[model samples]
Target: MNEQDVYDAIVTRRSTRNYKPTPVEPQKLARIIDAGRYAPSGGNSQTNRFFVVQKQEIIADLIKLVEEAFSKMDVYDGMYRSLRNSILRSKEGGYLFCYNAPVLVVVANKKDYGNNMADCAVAIENMMVEANALDLGSCWINQLRWLNEEPTLLEYMRKLGLPEDERVYGAAIFGYPATEDGKPNRVPLPRTGVDVVYL
Candidate 1:
């Protein structure tokens, strides 16, 4: 992709929270993951481990565990609005965090590393842009990272190849858009808080 293409992709990337029950092409998935792997790491540590999951069974199992975990928690004042919603929705039964996207990419890194989360965030953003370029809808899934330290979740994650010393820092769900036009909503919103300073 050229510079303009990259810029266009970034401009059009939007948070897609809904997806159809369709699988992504294997080669496109590989390209998205490759974009993540090429993301810059702090000091080039390259410690981020990307777990790409496409199996619906595994995704369903994870969703069940996530709902159960959220259901056990109490919503507190000042908590993130989305998390509070997750808890309430889980209690009502049927809470799919990834919006049923066919591809779930969880980025994990050493828990103690100062730049672990930062690196993971970069990788996720890279893949999100790549997904946009490929005309796929993508959304950031933060619930998993929020529950990274929960004992039950940790154990299950370990069984899925998450190292004992590692924890999820970020994740992204990607697949074809479920919209009628089959394209992600790309109209940019006004920049409100990202203030700029002139040197």
Candidate 2:
């Protein structure tokens, strides 16, 4: 692997919603997941599960199931903004949550684990940074986690080998960017809202 600044990769890793049909190389994808597997876990649980889905049919089915599940939901006041948006968009039709990325990595952890979400978040962050370093466009996908508890989704995921005691906490889609130059959009978006007051 060519040397790329880790801090640079972390800072420039933009969420790439639009992707080319090109798939990530098998080796690079392996490395991406490896990066996640190395993330620290609560009690060193190391219980995170990764479902690397590249099959078109499986991804298509997942999209359909997610849209179907979201379309039936009602948005409520104080609801998580993204979840509400997913529901509204699903109701309107044609919601491809993964942005047509050629590869999707679904992250799951023990449902009863107190640090499930935190562990999953760190894992996703590692994968995203690794993808950025490997020149793959990646985005954190939350829809799957939102639907993790839905019966239909749970059943379908189990059919795909998800253990009965675990639930999806996060997912990510990675592929070549659709940008004209075929590189991740590295334009810096200055962070303005993460307030920091040093003590």
Candidate 3:
């Protein structure tokens, strides 16, 4: 892709919350993961691990666990809006945190590493950008990270090869969008905030 194309992808990328049952192709998935792996790490610590979850059974179980974990929590006045939303919806039952996407990529890093979340975030952004370039819909999933320390989740994740010393810092979903055109929504939201200060 050229310079303008890169800018276009970055500017138009939007979080896709709905998806079709059709799975993302293996080759395209690999390329997207590679983009994440190539993300810069602090101090050359490339310890971020990627778990590409495409198995329907596993995804179902994850949704169950995530909903269960959030259902147990009570919303607070100052809690993040998304977190509060999750809690409220979860209590109501059947809260699919991953938006029922066909492919869920769970990014984990060393629990003791100070840069774990930052590294995973950088990597997730890269993967999302790459997904947009590939014409695949993607959304950053955060419920897993919020309940990373929950025993039920940790146990289940361990069964999926998550190391005991590592924890989920971030995650994302990728798949063909369920929209009429089967393409991600590229209509950029109105840019109103994120003001920059010139020093």
lDDT for each residue of candidate 1 in 10-62, tens digit (9 for 90 to 100):
98899998888789999999999999999999999999999999988888988
lDDT of 2 by residue, 31-104 (tens): 99999999999999999999999999999999999999999999999999999999999999999999999999
Model 2 residue 101 CA deviation in Å: 0.1
Give the winner by TM-score: 1 or 2.
1
What TM-score against the true fold does each predicted structure earn?
A: 0.96, 0.96, 0.97
lDDT of 2 at 15: 94
| Ranked candidates, highest TM-score first | 3, 1, 2
Model 3 misplacement above 4 A: none
Clashes of each: 0, 0, 0
lDDT of each: 0.93, 0.95, 0.95
Task: Report the Cα RMSD per candidate.
Answer: 1.1, 1.7, 0.9
Instruction: State in Å the error of residue 108, model 3.
Output: 0.3
Q: In model 3, what is the error at residue 112, expressed in angstroms?
A: 0.8
Best by TM-score: 3
Q: Mark the 10 consecutive residues where model 3 has the least summed lDDT.
A: 1-10
